[model samples]
Target: MRIGLLSFAHVHAEHYQALLRSMPGVELVGFWDDSVHAQSYAERYALKQYLTPQLLLAQALDAVIVCSETSRHREVVELSARAGVHVLCEKPIACTLEDAEAMRDVCAQHGVTFMTAFPMRFDPSCGELRQAVHSGQLGSILGVNGVNHSENPSVHRSWFANPALSGGGAVMDHVVHLTDLLRWCFACEVAEVYAALQWTDGAGENGTALDTAGIVLLTLTNGVQASIDCSWSRPATYPRWGHLKLDVIGTDSLMVIDAFADHLTVYPPDLTRPVQWLGFGVDPNQAMLTAFLDAVQRRQPPPVSWQDGYEATRVVLAAYTSAQQGRPVRLRPARCESTEDPGDGQGS
Candidate 1:
C-alpha cells in the first residue's frame, strides 16, 4: 500500500519514515512539509518531495499520516479526506473540541477510515494490565496513577513550546497518552476533571504562556478516580527522551506498568551525553502502524478510532478548563453500560 506522510514537524515523523521503509508491502510515498527541513529529509531518504499537500494527495495514495503541528491537523486531514484517502492522524486530533469533532464528522461523511496515532495502546505490558483488570484478576479498580514525563521538546523543535502550534505545553502533549490508556483499561469515559497547572520556569519556547507541568484528576463514569502527572520535567541531560508508567489500585491487588522498562541503561563515560537506554523490546509505533495497514487492507475500522481520539482530547481540554477556573469541570454524563469492553478495540 502507498502511504504518504503529510508533514515532518512531529518528532515521531522521522521514526515512522524509517519503519515504513523497512516494512514489507508498504511503500513510503515520499512526504510534504512546508518547512525547509523537508529538503534534507527528502535528500537523505531519496524520496520524492511533493511541493504541496494537494500534489501528494493526488498520487492515488491509499492512506496518509498527518504529522503536522498540533494545530494544523485539521487542515491536513481535511485535505486527505477530500481526496478519499484514509488517515492515521497524530494524537490530540485537534487543539479544540470543535475542530476535533469536525475532523471526525468529515471523515465519517466521506466514508474513509480515520485513526488516532496512539502507539502506547500497542504496548504489550499495557495490554496485559488491561486484561488483568477485565478478567477480574485485580478485582474492582479503585484508582489509577499514570505519568508521561518527557524532556522539553521545544529544545529540539521550536514549535513544541509555541502555544499556537502545540495547543498547550507539556499537559497537551502528555495527557492524551495516559487518558486514552485509562479509558482503555476501564472501558469507561471520564465524568469530571480537576487539574492544577504550574510552571517553575518563567516562560517556555517562543514565550509561550502554557504551563510546563500539571496534575490532572479525573473521575470516571464507573466511579474510578485517576490522576495523571503530565509534565515536561526532564532536563536535556536525562538519559532517555522520557518514559511512561502507571500504577493501578484495585480491591484485590495492585498493578503497575513500566511501559518502556524493557531496556538496558548504560552510563557512557563521555560527558557530552551522560547516559543512554538501549531497547530490544517491541516497538509500539511499529505495531500501531502494522495494525493501521492491516485494517486498511481488510477494509475494517482501525483499532483506535477518531472518536477515541476526540474523547481523550476532550478530557484533557476539560482539565485545562478546570485549572483555569480553579474548579472541577463536569462532562456530559453518559449512561453507564455493563459491557466488558468499550467496543472500539482500542477503547473510547
Candidate 2:
C-alpha cells in the first residue's frame, strides 16, 4: 500500500510515520507539512517533503493520513477524496459538526475509504474489556467512570488551546476517546449530556479562556449512565505523560482497565527533570495501522468508521452546550443502530 501523511502537526504523526516505515509491503511516501518542523521531519525520515498538498497528492498515492490542524481536516479530506485517495483522519475529526460531516460525505461521494484515527480501539487491554462487557461476564452494565487526563497539550502545540484551531480545550481534546469507547462497548449513543467546566488562567488567541478541565455526565440510549473526567491537569514533572482508565460497573461484577499500566519509573541523574516513565508494551498505534492497511488491501471497510468520529464529536459538543446552558442537553438519535457497535466498519 502506498500512503502519505498530510501534515506533521499532530504528535501522533511521529509514531504513524515510524510504523508506516516498518510495515511490510507498505510505502511511506513522504509527507506534506506547512510548519517549520517539516524540514527536520524530511531529514529524519529520509523522505522527500512536498511543498504543498497538491504536489504530494499528485503522486498517485493509494491513501493518506490527515493529521493537519483540527480546523483544516475538511480541506484535506475533501482534497484527498477528490484525488481518489482513501483517508485515515486524526481524532476530534474537525472543529465543528459541519466540517466533520462534510469530510464524511465527500469521502462517500468519491467512493474512497474514510477511517477515524481511534487507536484505543486496538489496545489489547481495551479489547479485552470490550469483550468482557459484550460477553455477559459483566452481566448487565450499570454505569461507567472514565478518566483521560493529560498535561496541557498547548505546551507542546499552542494550537491545542486555541478555540479557532481546536474548537475548545480539554473537553474537545479528551472527551472523544471515552465517548467513542462508551459507544463502542455499550453499542449506543449518548442521549443526553450535562457538564461543568473549569478554564485556564490565561486566554487564547482572542481573549477567550479555554476549558482546562471538565466533568461530563452522559446518558446512553441503551439506558446506561457514564461519567467522563477529563483535564489537562497533569504537571510537567509527572513521571508519565497522562493516563486513560475506565471502570465498568455491572450487576454481576466490575471491570477496571488502566491502559498505561505496563511501565517502569526511571529517576534520571539530571535534577532538573529527574523522573519519567518508560512505557513498555505493544504499540496500539501499530496495531491500528495494521488494521487500516489490512482493510485497504482486502477492499474491506476499516473497523473505525467516519460515523464513529462524528458521533463522538457530537457528544463533546453537547457537553459544551450543556455547560453553557447550565442544563442537560439532549442529542439527536444516532445514525448507527443502538443494538450494534457504533462503527459500522464501512470505511466510506
Candidate 3:
C-alpha cells in the first residue's frame, strides 16, 4: 500500500511517518507540508517532500494522513477526497461542526473512506474495558469518570494556543478522544453536554478565550452519565507527557483502565525527556493504521467511519456551546452506527 502524509504539522506526524516506513508491505511515499520545517523533515527522514499536496496525490497514493492544524483539516481532506484517496484525519476533526460535516460529506461524495484519528479505540486496556462492558462483566454501567491531561501543547507547537489555527484550547485538543471512546465502549452517543471551562489569562476577549482546563459532563443516549476532566494542566517537569484514564462505575462492579499504567518508568530520567517510560507493546496508533490499511487493501470501508468523526466533533462543539451558554446543551441523537436507543435510558 502506498501512503503519504499530507502535513507534518501535528506532533504525531513523525511517529506515523516512521510507523508507515517501518511497517511491512507499506510504502511511505513521502509527505507534503508548506511549513518551513518541511525541508528538515525530508532531510531527517530521507523521504521525498512534495512541494504541493496535488503533487503528492499525483503519485498514485492509496491514502494520506491529514495531520495539519485543526482549522486546515477541511481544505486538505477535500483535496485528498477529490483526488480519490482515503483519509485518516487527526482528531477533533475540525474547528467547527460545519467544517467537520463538509469534510465527511465531500469524502462520501467522492466515494473515499474517512477514518477519524481516534487511536484510543485500539488501545489494549480500552479494548478490555469494552469487552467487560459488552460481555456483562461490568453488570449495568452506572457512570464514568475519564481524565485526559497533557503538558500545554503550545510548547510543542505555537499554533495550539492560537485559537484561529488550532481551535479552542485544551478542551478541543482532548475532548474528542475520550468522547469517541465512551461512545464506542457504551454503544451510544452523547445526548447532552454540560461543560465548565477555565480560560487562559488575557485570552477571554470577544468570547475567544483559549480553554486551559475543563470538565465536560455528558449524558449519553442510553442515559449513562460520564464526565471528562480534560486539561493542559500538566507541567513540563511532570513525569509523563500525557495521561489517559477511565473509570467505569457499574451496579455490580467498577472498572478502571489507565493507558500508561503498564509502562516501565525509569527514575533517573533520560536527558532528552522529563522521564523515561518504556514498554514493548503495540501502540494504538499502529493498530489503528493497520486497521485502516487492511480496509483499504480489501477495498472495504474503514473500521472507524466518517460518522464517528462527525459525532465526536459534535460533542466537542456542544461542550463549547454549553460552556458559553452556561447551561447544558441538549444534542439531538445522530443517525450513525449507534445501537438502538433504549427509550428514556433507565440507569443508576
**Model 1 clash number:** 0
Q: Which regions in candidate 3 have their CA more than 4 angstroms from the true location?
A: 202-208, 267-273, 337-348
lDDT per residue (tens digit) for residues 109-128 in model 2: 88888888998888878888
> CA lDDT of 314 in candidate 1?
87
**What is candidate 3's CA lDDT for residue 65?**
95
TM-score of model 3 relative to the true fold? Answer: 0.92
Which lDDT values do the candidates have, in the order given?
A: 0.86, 0.86, 0.85
Each model's TM-score, in the order given?
0.94, 0.94, 0.92
Candidate 3 to native Cα RMSD, angstroms: 4.6
Candidate 1: tens digits of C-alpha lDDT, residues 54-84: 9999999999999999999999998888899
lDDT of 3 by residue, 163-227 (tens): 88887888889999999889888888899999999987754334455798999999999989999
Better of 1 and 3 by lDDT: 1
Candidate 1's C-alpha runs over 4 A off are: 200-202, 267-271, 334-348
Evaluate model 1: give its lDDT.
0.86
Error of 3 at 33 (Å): 0.8
